[model samples]
Target: MVSKVNDLDYFVAASEQEALILELNLIKRHHPRYNVRLKDDKTFPYLKIDLNEDWPRVHITRRLEEDGGRYFGPFASAKSVRQTLKLIKGIFPFRSCSKPITGTDTRACLDYDIGHCLAPCIGAVSQKEYAEVIKRVILFLEGKQERVVQQLKSKMNRAAEALDFERAVRLRDQIQAVEQVVEGQRIATTVKGEQDVIAFAGDKDQACVQVFFIRSGKLIGRESFLLQGTR
Candidate 1:
């Protein structure tokens, strides 16, 4: 039994399950207007990639399905997912435009000028080639990083063979970027396989859990969450 701090109201339960049942029954009986979330149907957002389309686009979404396109996560934070999407757009140059680029004569967006995109919006790259980039990005999101690294290595070697030193150097830098991500993963997950490291702190009233996701011996990302009340 637990007594209210400021009122004579009291609650009692035989066990954890009974406690939950009692709490739910109380909420339903009273139908308290102060509990906003109790009547809401909202859920956290996710990252969705529509690979089935001819021109795939990655977007932050709230929908969930077992579709063909890739889905990254039910991220703990919308800000983190947005930031990650930005980084992915920068590296992979996947199109972010909502409308189809077909038959449009407009110039490339600012992202193209800054090299953040491959300019698929204006025929700078073919749909087929852009699809290839999307494939690589999907592989990366799935933690099969070696695919991208190996492709970059081949390109670097070919550039070097043709005496295109500048291009070869550029490819080398991209390869290094991929390697850095891989190394970070290795340090985060010392184990040989995919595993998640989670740590929790706090007492009965409030608590937070930090989760680190390691895939293919790499530390890809981390998230944290706070829980209110005892469970």
Candidate 2:
């Protein structure tokens, strides 16, 4: 007889996203043979931006917690995850360092000099403005390409009207980045839900299951699995 899930120890997260992340970690660490398909080497990475923090720096992590931070992926690999991060950071100019944003620094760091960070440590960007930038980053990650594009267009127009051509050019680049990501996704549905569309192709001995992840009406990413003992 199979043991009941309720009879086993369990941990709860604040949301389904966190719970799913936890389940993946547990399956990975334990290597339960029952989850042969999921234990494959293609461990998807995540873009973790802790909005809960005052100076949220984006990170790529495989682990998740219930700390109220926004989780982006389960991406196919580190390379692709970094590509997405690059796009967002290039446009938003968030802090790349892990240092705490205590605002006590005497001068800007190398990241600030290199145009990689907004230098929140020295008040280069106000907290409210940084929060807005982070919001845009979140929107981009959430696959709301149209919304982000519109926001950028509005900002670009304002910059141009104010004779800030340099700012307008930057906004244009940001719009393009958002659109580039959107253009690549093959729309799977018009439904409203965070769900996976699973399909498989195989024979009696083995099979490969493809999972297309859709969130907020956009296809975010996908993972495929090769499995044993297919019926």
Candidate 3:
């Protein structure tokens, strides 16, 4: 391969990290023959919260932009990301719709009818209240579910005390759901702290790497990367 080369090209960067980034970009663009290649390499999905909006909405995105909103997870798979979104939507009544929030919609959308949304579009929920919900969602995504559960428990107690039985019931259900998810997480490590467990497998032509993200001993998330050019 080296003997066949007619000429050489080079690039320089200000820092090692910058150089690595440039190298990755070049490899992605040109798919160099000798470079180890990722099979089906694509940008992983992220949960984006655009706070710039009048009512920030949490949804999935593949691109990371400088839109001044919080982004979470270059998660393993689209299916897992969507499942996480569904779980969050079930617990927090944030708006999933893209419709403008004028608070004047004549009718709430199906998301509202199905109890998946707070219907901010129709003024069913105040901006301040919706913001609080978004806060919990962010906390949940950050693997700070304990803090979120504490907040929910506090609110649930208050609602029950105030005789808002419906709201109290909703909060109770959310707390239970969070607890169930937490309990379902297996203890992937005995070290008693957060760490990633990585494993790799390969053949002559292909390889796969798996990562298990453990937080406080619990298996929180996992991702797999497939690679080619193993020979």
Error of 2 at 51 (Å): 3.0
lDDT of 1 by residue, 1-231 (tens): 234234566777785434644555566567766655433344455778997788888999865666787787666568988987876675676778887777355898887776656676677878886787788788777778788999879988999999999768856876787777777667743468767789999987999999987666667788788999955
Stretches of model 3 off by over 4 angstroms after superposition: 1-42, 186-189, 198-210, 224-231
> What is the lDDT of every predicted structure here?
0.74, 0.80, 0.84
TM-score of 1: 0.70
Candidate 2, position 225, lDDT: 95
Clashing pairs in 3: none
How does model 3 score by TM-score?
0.77
> Model 2: what TM-score?
0.68
- Using lDDT, give the best candidate's number: 3
| Per-residue alpha-carbon lDDT of candidate 2 for residues 91-191, written as tens digits (9 for 90 to 100) | 67799887777777889988778666779998778899788778888877767778888988999999999999987887787788678778776475767
The residue-level lDDT of candidate 3 at 197 comes to 86
Residue 173, candidate 3: C-alpha displacement in angstroms? 1.0
Error in Å for residue 152 of model 2: 0.9
Worst-scoring 10-residue span by lDDT in model 1? 35-44
What total of clashing residue pairs does each candidate reach? 2, 0, 0
lDDT of 3 by residue, 1-231 (tens): 989788898987996435654665677788877876532366668899999998999999976677899988666679988999998988888988887789998999888887778898888998888899999999988888889899999999999999999989988988998888788786745597768789999998999999987878778877789999986
